[model samples]
Target: MNWLRRMMYGRYGSDQLNVAMLVLSIALLLVSRLLRIRIFYWLSFILLVLCYLRMFSRNITRRHEENQKFLRYWFPMRERWYRMTDNLRDCRTHRHFKCRNCGQKLRVPRGRGKVSITCPRCGNQFLGKT
Candidate 1:
């Protein structure tokens, strides 16, 4: 692996943006194959090429800037996805309610049978059945 290491010595190698691109490319490829769509196939090919180009790019500053910009958009979306998944996972054991006063989300245990919920943010009192 010495030759490979030396070849990548000054390259940007890989980052989250590259990984996301690669994953998107693969997903598109699968979709193209399953649905026989030529446009998706071409888009997947382009994304794969871009991913490789970014990986072996010698311009570190530009690659870093691109990755940072991607991250600025990715993090909040990822957090929302995680929060949604967590809520789905917790649905069996907990219940979620929104405060009518300030639109704050509140979680309560399951089977609580009409309990009073107070919003921590706005101190709004509401009744919810869990």
Candidate 2:
């Protein structure tokens, strides 16, 4: 453990981008094995190598910048994914609707029959069946 710490003392270490790359590499490897695709196997190997290179890099600033750029793209997509999953999980108890006037997403309780929805953003009233 002491030797490992010494080895990584000046390294950039792991960041979100590296972790994501590692996960994607593993997923690609699994897909390659399942589909018997040689290209995916190679791609996964390349990604794995890149992940390790980034982890052991000595340029901390560059690694930080790369992680920031990755986050800028990853956060919004991640939020959308979480929102979709949450909506799926809540499908039994809630209904989701978009306001036609302002396109704001509104959540309404399920089995409410016909209800009037007021958009809080623009105060747009719309009727929908829940």
Candidate 3:
């Protein structure tokens, strides 16, 4: 059991959203089984495997194409996973700033907007409005 945990621990990206995908994939597989949906099992299982591979896989274009072809067969569920992975792979970069005093990074999604933040660690204020 401990070995299984250790093995799977770093199998995917360590983030809230990525962990959510792993959990949701498991739930989807189980639900598909309970509902006696044969295609659902395959779709969910494939999505689960791809989701794990994403942790190490690069060149998202191939994955996106594969997922797109898979989505043609299963529209609803597969589409969601496809879009989710797509969004993760293709995210817009925003202006990011950090406080030198406290080293707290702040993400401003306004695309180079005027923003200011104070360092919570040292209470040092600066004009971060980039």
Candidate 4:
């Protein structure tokens, strides 16, 4: 592992953007293969190249800036994905509701009857059964 560490010593190395690009590339490759689409193949190749280029880049500052920019958009989507998974996992144990005023997400325990939900964001009050 000494050689690998030395090789990456001055490189930007891996980041979330790199991993996301790799996954995107694989997804594109699968779709391209299944659909026999030439455009997706090219897009996947481009993504792979970009991923490698970012990995091997010596400009750490630029890479960090790029990663921060990527995260600005990635984080919200990631949070939503996490929330969806959590909701699915707790489907039997908890109930999720959206605030009618601010659209904020609220969670209450399952099987609670006629619970009054107060929206923390907009201070809206509503009654619902959990």
Q: List lDDT for all candidates, in order.
A: 0.94, 0.96, 0.64, 0.95
Residue range 15-119, candidate 3, lDDT tens digits? 333455677777878888799878778777776776667655555565556555655655677678999887665446545567786788765554556656666
Higher-lDDT candidate among 2 and 3? Answer: 2
Model 4: residue 37 alpha-carbon error in angstroms: 0.5
Q: What is the lDDT of candidate 2?
A: 0.96
Candidates 1 and 4: which is better by TM-score?
A: 1
Q: Name the candidate that leads on lDDT.
A: 2
Q: Identify the superior model by lDDT, candidate 1 or candidate 3.
A: 1
Per-residue lDDT over 47-100 for candidate 1, one digit per residue giving the tens place of the 0 to 100 score: 999999998999999999999999999999999999999878899899989999
lDDT of 4 at 64: 96
Clashing pairs in 1: 111-130
Q: What would the per-residue lDDT of candidate 4 be over residues 1-130, giving only the tens digit for each residue?
A: 9999999999999999999999999999999999999999999999999999999999999999999999999999999999999868898898889998889999899897998999999999999899
Residue runs of model 2 more than 4 Å from their true location after superposition: 95-130
Ranking by lDDT: 2, 4, 1, 3
Q: How many steric clashes between backbone atoms does each model show?
A: 1, 0, 1, 0
Q: After superposition, how far is residue 112 of candidate 3 from its true place, in Å?
A: 54
Which candidate number has the best TM-score? 1
lDDT of 1: 0.94
lDDT of 2 by residue, 1-130 (tens): 9999999999999999999999999999999999999999999999999999999999999999999999999999999999999878899898999999989999999898999999999999999899
